[model samples]
Target: MSIILTVRRIDIEETLNTTPSVLPQIKMTAQLNEDRIWIDGCFDFVHHGHACAMLQARRTSNNKENSMLFCGVHNDAAIEYNKGTLPVMNAPERYAHARSIRWCSAVVEDAPYVTAPEWMDRFGCQYVIHGDDVTLDANGEDCYTIMRKMNRFKMVKRTYGVSTTDIIHRILTHNTLPSTDKDYFPTLDELEFCSKGVDGFSNHCYVFQDDLNNMLVRGGYDWDSTNSVLILGDFDLFHMGHIDQLKKIRNVLEPRRQIIIGVTSNESKEIIMTIKERVLSLLSCSFVDGVIIHPSKDTIENSSHDEKSKFSKVYNIDSPELVDGTVFSGYLTSRTIIARIETQRDMYVERNKRKGMPI
Candidate 1:
């Protein structure tokens, strides 16, 4: 079966350029004819967990009618005031991340932690979706109580691994050494190992080098045999733009080809995210097959250079080389394509609804 990927685009320049204010206002769209599923939370560091929640929201729609997933992220002040700590990523950063996800159609800026009925009505929301986890306000009251009482809320099963807090803890305790057993670290905040083998790689981070090596040994993937696409970038503040680029690459390559991403750990003054954060973000995306961490700066700069290349010799061929009977080429997507993508996404959703299928 083929996977149907959803995509949404707000004004590209406006979304990128706008600075999210402390008390950002929500500008309601004039066209709210379709069924809208609303997901509200502080979507910081937009990981697999958040993506799964959006998917669940879409599934909950049941494809009976035209539906869109609108996410409402809590502003920085609300998060700090209630949770006693500020989010790792700021409001604008989080907004950009949310806007980039394919499943999310619209975002409600400066969303209140406790959503009101009027708020739901304002967005034409039939269901307000959230994870199974119960969230409490600063006053120790259930934030979603009102929605639950009104039967407008639905809870999706929370993903088992890699939370925003877990990433924060990893960053906070980045200097510690791995334990001898390597099952887990002794620190209060420890990264866990993937025990379920290669299949478990998506859910958890491999803490031990031996564990990862063991998976590689058991899986036995022939690197040179496969036609692979090598993507090299910092991938900081990973968003839909990054995913779109990867998707474009995937569309051109043969299905047998693997997509390996090289995330440079080289520090930059302008980068807001740490190297670990960047690596985890890249790993979370489904399009990526493998990630190379901390590649040498010199090697990354001269990847096309005719020298001792660590990449397989097949990819090391000179300019105008052909791999798997396909010529190596590049593309730069234009702004006009954004509108087409948005239109296509709408058509796809409508078609799925007509067929009684989930998108």
Candidate 2:
């Protein structure tokens, strides 16, 4: 048999200077070398918007010799300090992800416990670039002074500042809002009406602000342990996972504030729900003040039912009336409604329902 020969060619364009070397990973920075603009961040959740930010930075820097982006990984401690948790992806993983981008020139692991001052001093960075959405003065007054003095700092506008947290919340809400961490809040007053007048937007979502502090005005009825106000949303399929999220929020405001989670209605086209189970899910948490439902028909105007207890307010945000038209039938609802939830989690829930489960 004649021997068959096959040759495979591989092209390695740039250098892999920092990684797969040793322990105590290095702290590296992307510079405006003779030719390229370097973009750096934890880049934990690489996204479409992130890609755009990199592209814009590259164009702005106009590095002739380096036509690519440089990303820097912060040490584990750095990530925890800044983002309040450990990184979703580790160093080596982040390094490889950054390098995979066609625009990226290199990826390196940053040293642990290194401050920006130490980094600037070590890298002798000609210039440091970042996404516009990132806070320039995150460290403190001293950081501003350092960057100002070095004159090596640069920022590119972030076309999409959408964060990883936002993405996660959307996924959770859509797929696991009720089941993720379900908690029930009792209501001071509960009422049922098969009919509701379309409440037009009175823009009644009011936030209570004092001279020095801001607090939510909740009509606490059932919660005794935590004098706090309770706020829940479209808590479909109510599960312990959801309880985890609600309880965390409650713990801070607890004894001061607990939550009265509003279950989403499946009646209208405007409010999409999760699981789409014909049966309504029930919440069973002692900390929960009570559960309440929205009126199918109304006093469309967000008129306060003064005769009824004060706990009545909008429940589901997915309801069109909450964001749009209001009740005009000689009824008026308070412009200040307190159904607060973490903005990030709220976004997550909306995204989840659409993918399949329904929030």
Poorest stretch of ten by lDDT in candidate 2 = 193-202
lDDT tens digits, residue span 1-359, model 2? 11111111111123342233431234434332423333456665444344445545545544434243445566556766754455544555455544544344455467332225444333333455655443422353232344546675676665432355544444344333342332122111111110001111011111121110122332223323223232435443232334334444444424454344444444432221232211112221323443334322322222434424233333333233232332221121111101122334454354444434345
Clashes of 2: 72
TM-score of each: 0.51, 0.39
Model 1 scores worst on lDDT over the 10 consecutive residues at 188-197
lDDT of 1 by residue, 1-359 (tens): 11112223244213422343411344444333225678988997687567667766766764533456767889999998987666656686577667645456667788898887666666567678888988899898989999999887888888655466544333333322232334221221211211111122323222212111222212124443125555666665465456655654556643456566665533432333454445545554545555555445543443445433334322221122322332111221112223333445544344334434434
Error of 2 at 18 (Å): 9.5
User: Candidate 1 regions off by >4 Å?
Assistant: 1-34, 175-229, 233-359
**Could you say which candidate leads in lDDT?**
1
Go through the candidates in order and give the C-alpha RMSD of each one to the true structure.
Answer: 15.1, 22.6
